[model samples]
Target: MSGRWWLLPGTLCTAEVFEPLLGALAVSPQQCRSVRLDRPAVEDYAAELASVEDEDIVLGFSLGAILAAHHLDRMRALAAVLIAANPFADTPEKSAARLEQLARISVEGPGAVMAAAWPALVGPDARENPAVGNRIVAMAEQTVQDLPAQTELALRRPGAEPMLASARSRALFITGREDPAAPPDRAMRAAAIGRHELVLVDGAGHFLPLEAPRACAEAIRAFLLGRGQDRS
Candidate 1:
């Protein structure tokens, strides 16, 4: 098991989103450190991420995964585990859609946005659970105190392909089979381009860490252990 790790949570998420997965992985809090999206500029985010030691493991989720993919070369050892990653570039159409989302957040409030996003964020099984949906909404609403600023940080993220290609061997991508936002195919595209491993959890959605913690943890363990074996 790795002794230290640097965790990056997704947009509007605190390190709390990682609690379930970390518990599932049997990693102690002392061995882990996490960062939030306080910085507005992408460069600022990268500058802050540089604090991670070369030997420490990285585990990033969603938007956090996208950031990790761009900054892969910074870490010299222990491949990053990027979960529910969306490595695609931002297109004009996509940006426009996001603008609409931002507009909605302004008019209807963050809770309304979270309501619309909940079903798409989880698979059918998780959607059926009131507790799961409620928690996602609550967490998103709580952590996203600065909703507009947090939303803006992810607006113009550059394509991750070029960045990942240089440090292809230092990353692994994991995604949910049913994830509409970052499906298996998208993760596969990244894995293929980056020349890294890809793991797809069955019946999972964008929130794999919470939806299927055991499966997510198993894949992370296998990647870390198997990668170690490869070096041996």
Candidate 2:
């Protein structure tokens, strides 16, 4: 019943972000693998995914979830998809504003963006755990510069809402109740089409896979197993 699994990271996030999830899932019967997509346009990202066929599941987080939706076509042979902490919207206005804000971040510098985004992405423990906080901040500061241009390009590209709506693959949307970036409503709306499943974590923040790794992994395992049962 189990097969290969792919874990795609969030925007500006490397495979390291999914370490906890991957480690926990490693014991599963399925083969666990991770993919790192560079800062690229949605279509281009989708193109890359076109080559990733035959996997049982593709678990995409944050911006990676959006790409998963955009590239759902590339995963026709897969079992299902788990999109985490994504700002799922079909409107152009939201996309436009997002692109614009990203552009500003690109111009103003990642420090400014990180200063604003860090608080929203992580919980207060981020401040308390100076080591973790400092590491993520450093990574964000380095990657935020490319984010604006990358996001703007993605915004201009066609959204995958329609694609996801049509795809037969079961979609599971996971969100943290405390996450300000990707609210529950947003996740719910994004998964309105197809067989959509939603799971909310009470105390977790946007970085649920990092902050509440065990809970996040448990939810994903349950969702995947449930979806498999439905297919059976």
Candidate 3:
């Protein structure tokens, strides 16, 4: 259990929009931690990330992947779980249309819902790289007044496809390919729940690590070297 890379930011993100996947995962040799959740109400922002531990290698994004699929089973030594352009739930009217789009982006604000979620979070060459779309819309206008009340507490939590339907960890669902917010059919129904792996950067979108941070840090360092993780 020697892996430790965290970096989870999205939804009016910070940590400088994961500064190019933390500088291409700091040329990974392990140990890369850069977390941020400054309020998007999943029980008061994931209860201050309840001391993030348990094997570590989370790497969430977009509403921090619904608070890392609800605190990834109490952070139980997670070896892999890297959802980027996040979104889950196959139906129930798409989780009630994502809770009516988080109550219309918390009453039409978060900079008009991040200027209507920046054309579904850049691509087309990172929206022609105006310094990567003005540094990811200046980190979504510096956390656009707390992302519509933390996206209305993550659209009233509990929908990462039945909380990662029978999750055995070791998952990956990074997306983009013209992501109009969690596109790619919401990462193919969140990679058919559990035991997943589905990347689609090809022309990026939905902030794929601020528009392709070295192809989202080499697809999360090849999913932490296909879950072997030691890398040494």
Candidate 4:
């Protein structure tokens, strides 16, 4: 049975964020589908993804990765790719910071959150690239309407260490060298628990798929092929 690719976007992004990476992978629209995860609660959000097939290759980014990890038991996946994922338990400081960001979003609105998070979301090179920076900002704006709920869900989501540690499906965890949200060290630790291969992309920040689509795609492609699950 041939497996399909399921591209999952982060909290402040839509399926469009995966467009460049999908193109780089030379994936046909019919062979791959983007799953929208705009729901507020983790359970509700995970429920929305019940349509995923047993043979689907789940590739999740950030919050989506968290959700994917949460629901790994239900996915009978061919393989899983986690990009800039925070699969470990959240720290007190991290939880507090997320709550503070939520509060700011509630009062100051999404624009303020975006402004504060922009630096950590992309690499220095992306900040210099007007097109990439603007695109990231625009995508954030588009999904900011759901930021409050998304933030709440992300902050409250459970850790995936136990689940990933026992997962039978081959997994790949990719992190950005400069990602403040999920640094390489933290990601490495998490990947160790799952026994997943970890790849750190140079000069990338939190949004590795968007910041380094070609590199991300290549890693994903090689992973899939290595596992003999080539969708191509």
Residue 134 accuracy (lDDT) in model 1: 73
lDDT for each candidate structure: 0.76, 0.64, 0.64, 0.77
Best by lDDT: 4
Compose the digit string of candidate 3's lDDT tens values, residues 122-227.
Answer: 7787666667656655776676666556655565665666556755466677777787767786666667676467777788777777777887677676776764
What lDDT, from 0 to 1, does candidate 2 have?
0.64
Give the C-alpha lDDT of model 1.
Answer: 0.76
Report lDDT (Cα) of residue 171, candidate 2.
72
- Please give, for residues 1-232, the per-residue lDDT of candidate 2 as tens digits: 2556676777666556666767776745246566655555676665556656564677788877777776665575354545454535436676766776677665876666666666666656644555555555676665664575457555655656776777746677777777766777777766665657777776767776777777667777787667422210
- Ranking of candidates on lDDT, top first: 4, 1, 2, 3
TM-score of each: 0.90, 0.78, 0.30, 0.88
Best by TM-score: 1
Residue-wise C-alpha lDDT for candidate 4, range 78-139, written one tens digit per residue: 78888898887789988888888767777876666676677767888877766676666677
**Model 2 misplaced regions, further than 4 Å:** 27-35, 80-83, 87-112, 124-127, 141-145, 227-232
By summed lDDT, the worst window of 10 consecutive residues in model 3 runs over 223-232
lDDT of 4 at 222: 80
The Cα error of candidate 2 at residue 62, in Å, is 0.8
RMSD to truth, every model: 3.1, 4.2, 15.4, 3.5
